[model samples]
Target: MAFSADELRVLRRALATALNPAPLQGEDVQDCLRLAEAVDDAVREAGRLRAFLLADLARYREALPGSLPGYLELLQDALAAGYDPAVDDLAALRALRANPRAAVLLDRCQVLAERSVRARLARVTQTAVATTPRPRVRLLALPGGRAADEPKPTPAPPPAERPVPKPSEVFPPRRRPVPPPPPEERAAG
Candidate 1:
């Protein structure tokens, strides 16, 4: 992503053109358009790579304690890449928390998850305010003022009818006690 001096000069000229229209050679305009397209392509490629990384991480997680080493490595790489931890990721880390690395990642992932959730809630709030219809309140006038009959305003739905879940409900306790596979079946398994 490092830009050469020539590219920097072109970028500066392009930005100046944006602020104030000026006659420019066709070559300069073409360069700016090409740069913009290149940036867009880079963004799309990054998104695809991130999606692949997340799917691979999920696969590794499903493999459980056996995939511990790879999963931890991938998780750290993902965190560095600004990946937000989903519930499954948090659960996986919690299950593996006995490993010191997993414990640290669990704490990190929890913070990332909380921040991601808060960001989403904020976006939803903004969208709701911008797009949701406001309930119309009917006004009734006293005898001194002129009044006209109007339909009653519909009530707003009860806010968030479902209760917020407790932490335990969101993240259940770790592994259940299960008898190890009987010796007779271990080899077959």
Candidate 2:
């Protein structure tokens, strides 16, 4: 059963008091803990019930035919049941049919979903762009106050100096460095 607003409010107040208290009677403390656990269990059960209903609805839609009248009736029922037909009912219908009407509904649902996604993506893109630093586009004033699009002046390179030799390059060259003379010294060359 759904929790009434008054009951939820009372529970919230009790939880807040329990959480903030320095001490309480053992019975009161136990009651608070028990109530909290019950609330959690109730929420879990509600979620499970919702999921079961959705699955059953999907199965029902899949088993139903896709004529215009039938589709309209299904849409009406779904709406009356507080389901979003575009997002929820249409997907179930798509899984059920190869008919033209089913294909149309599927296409419509996809378009709706795409538009919703695009809107969300646009908002995120806008937010990201707003947060990023934009490159400064400076206009150079030429002689006689004419603005010119000259290439940006690159910073001068550091004064050139002789490159230091790497460790390997600095080392003495070994023409075919003896192959580590052999474990046994050959008879005096």
Candidate 3:
């Protein structure tokens, strides 16, 4: 963006007018308009450059762990140059974090990945609700084959309840014979 002598003169005059707040001559007005257009073009060019760098950064990110030579270096350089990380960049970096060799990028990738998820979640929450159809409800009948017009049969009466017997009535105690102490004691007696 090397400005020629004529363009530099015009820019200086434009700046002077902007700072001093003076009414501009016809030529000065033209120069100011040209400078404004140049500023806009510069802004657009900067945006394009950022887009290019971000795209390149994403490509490098995708080639991670087993990336080609200089891929990581390029990615880091892009980060240093303020290239914004895209969702895909964060995802690729997250995938790479599982590699032992990717330890250096793990924390950075994790933070960016978390931010990406939050951003996506915010976007989804802002969208209209999903368009799934509401389910229809219908009546369900019992398994009995009786017709609706027929008289219902009465249910059978329950059996009489039986009383529980005492534990002694259920089981009788058994009698056992007593054994003598010892043969020596019996001989002494």
Total backbone collisions for each predicted model:
0, 0, 0
Query: lDDT tens string, model 1, 10-37?
Result: 8999999989999989999899988888
Instruction: Estimate the TM-score of every prediction.
Output: 0.66, 0.40, 0.44
Candidate 2, residue 55: how far the Cα is off, in Å: 1.0
* lDDT tens digits by residue: candidate 2, 108-157: 56666677678889999999999999899998655643234455578999
> What lDDT score belongs to each candidate, Candidate 1 first?
0.90, 0.65, 0.71
Best by TM-score, which number? 1
**By lDDT: ranked, best first:** 1, 3, 2
Off by over 4 Å in 2: 1-20, 66-88, 91-157, 160-189
Cα error of candidate 1 at position 14, Å: 0.4
The total number of steric clashes, by the backbone 3 Å criterion, in model 3 comes to: 0
How do the residues 23-111 of candidate 3 rate in per-residue lDDT, one tens digit apiece? 88898888878877887898899789877877776676566656633565666666676554556655665666656545466466567
Best by lDDT: 1
CA shift at 168, candidate 2, in angstroms? 40
Which run of 10 residues does model 1 get worst, by summed lDDT?
A: 143-152
Return the TM-score for candidate 2, rounded to 2 decimals.
Answer: 0.40
